[model samples]
Target: MWKMELKLTDKLAIERTRLANERTFLAYFRSAIVFLSSGFAIIKLEMLREVIWIGYALIVIGPILFFIGLFRMLYVKKRIKKSYQNDPD
Candidate 1:
């Protein structure tokens, strides 16, 4: 009975970790979208002509954010897999 309880607890913890990981990825994705949209707006709007560098910077940052987020998600996934494997329960 104790072993069964431990297993159930471990399973729940793992599920929670996975959900948290997904939430983090979604947050990153949202940030990337915001960066991309802001970049587009700056580049397209005539008022931003005096400071076009900001727009280009945002455009460059958008993809960087996306890739960084991707890398973090994969890294967390691998870590989680390792944790699960190491768990005796």
Candidate 2:
């Protein structure tokens, strides 16, 4: 009798895809950070400081993008599960 068996489950089969997804998420996070920093800089700028709405809008947009990336990950996870569960025929 064999002590162990080697198999490729659906989740394991798509590991690279999952990793790519993670990399994409990190990229979005980087963009979000850049936007946040830009917003703070704008707030500190003498001439631009008066534009309170622009600063506030940028700050709000950064977090919204981050949350969108987070939700995309969740959506992809569900898609992966469904793909793995489907029958080939």
Candidate 3:
């Protein structure tokens, strides 16, 4: 296996990129949790009986959002790894 030698700046930049990716993933996870919780709340609460469909929609969307986020994070991480491995610098 070939390894790339990274400069301090390049290493720092990559670290930042990784952190940013993690933050984005966390945001997505948070949103998914919120949606799922809200959906459950709406479904269980007696007051929101009329809008049950909205609850179901949110429930469906929550997992989709989570998977999308997971996929994106993995894709970006893969791209970053690829770039670094192929780096000529």
Candidate 4:
């Protein structure tokens, strides 16, 4: 009975960790979309002819956000794997 409970708990923990990782990635994706959309809108609409640099900056930032998110997701996954190996219930 104790072993069964431990197995269930470990499964829950792994699932929770996966969900958290997914949520974090989604958050980053959302931010990238917002930045990319705003940049495209600014450029297409010519919203700020005098300060076009801002639009360019945002466009650059969008990809950076994506890469950062990807890196973070990989890092977290690795950490989780290590932890699981060290103390798997």
Candidate 5:
């Protein structure tokens, strides 16, 4: 239960934080997709045979980046909820 009522500014600030979090997650997701796509493209293209290692590295890094973003987003979301719930102001 909320200990105290929230003012209009407080509510707006919280909403802004949530929106920002979503935007950040989207950015991470977009980057992951780009990396994954580039990795696959490089691997499939015969002209880029010399730097195949880079393609493999990118493939591995893409999922890691996705998971990192996922965890960070969830952690921040939970923290925000807990903070507002417990705080009196």
Candidate 6:
């Protein structure tokens, strides 16, 4: 009788990795929100002439971080997949 060979990835720590990715994403998201909020606060303070510089920074920082977070998460997932496939077991 022939025995079927199953891969180690079939039991890899996928759930943990996913959770970690989510946590990291959320952290970035929170930072983005805070930056955007700061921008809005500055805009609302009637100091647009003087504080406009900070507003521009906030406008760019949030989205930039969000995209970076998304890309990094995908990269990490790919790396984990590779590790799983190269398991010694």
Best by TM-score: 5
Candidate lDDT scores, in order, read 0.87, 0.77, 0.91, 0.83, 0.89, 0.76
Residues 1-89 of candidate 2: C-alpha lDDT, one tens digit per residue: 22233256744667877888888889889888988888888888888866867877889999999999889988897797566544231
Instruction: Give the count of colliding residue pairs in each prediction.
Output: 0, 0, 0, 0, 0, 0
- Top lDDT prediction, candidate number: 3
TM-score of model number 5: 0.92
Q: Please, what are the lDDT tens digits per residue for candidate 4 over residues 4-83?
A: 23476787888799789989998999999999988887887755887777778899999999999999999998888766
Pairwise TM-score winner, candidates 1 and 3: 3
Q: Over 4 Å off in model 4, which ranges? A: 1-6, 86-89
lDDT of 5: 0.89
Runs in model 1 with CA error above 4 Å? 1-6, 86-89
- Candidate 6 per-residue lDDT, tens place, 1-89, comes to 34445455655566577689889988988888888888777777874768788987897898898888889888987787676654443
Clashing pairs in 4: none
Give the alpha carbon lDDT tens digit for every residue of 12-85 in model 5. Answer: 89989988999999999999999999999999999999999999999999999999999999999998998788
What ranking of all candidate models by TM-score puts the best one first?
5, 3, 1, 4, 2, 6
Q: CA RMSD for every model? A: 3.9, 6.4, 3.1, 4.1, 2.7, 5.1
Candidate 3 yields a Cα-based lDDT of 0.91
TM-score of each model, in listed order: 0.86, 0.72, 0.89, 0.83, 0.92, 0.71
Error of 5 at 46 (Å): 0.8
Report the C-alpha displacement of residue 70, candidate 6, in angstroms. Answer: 0.7
Q: How many residue pairs clash in model 4? A: 0
| Candidate 3 backbone collisions, by pair | none
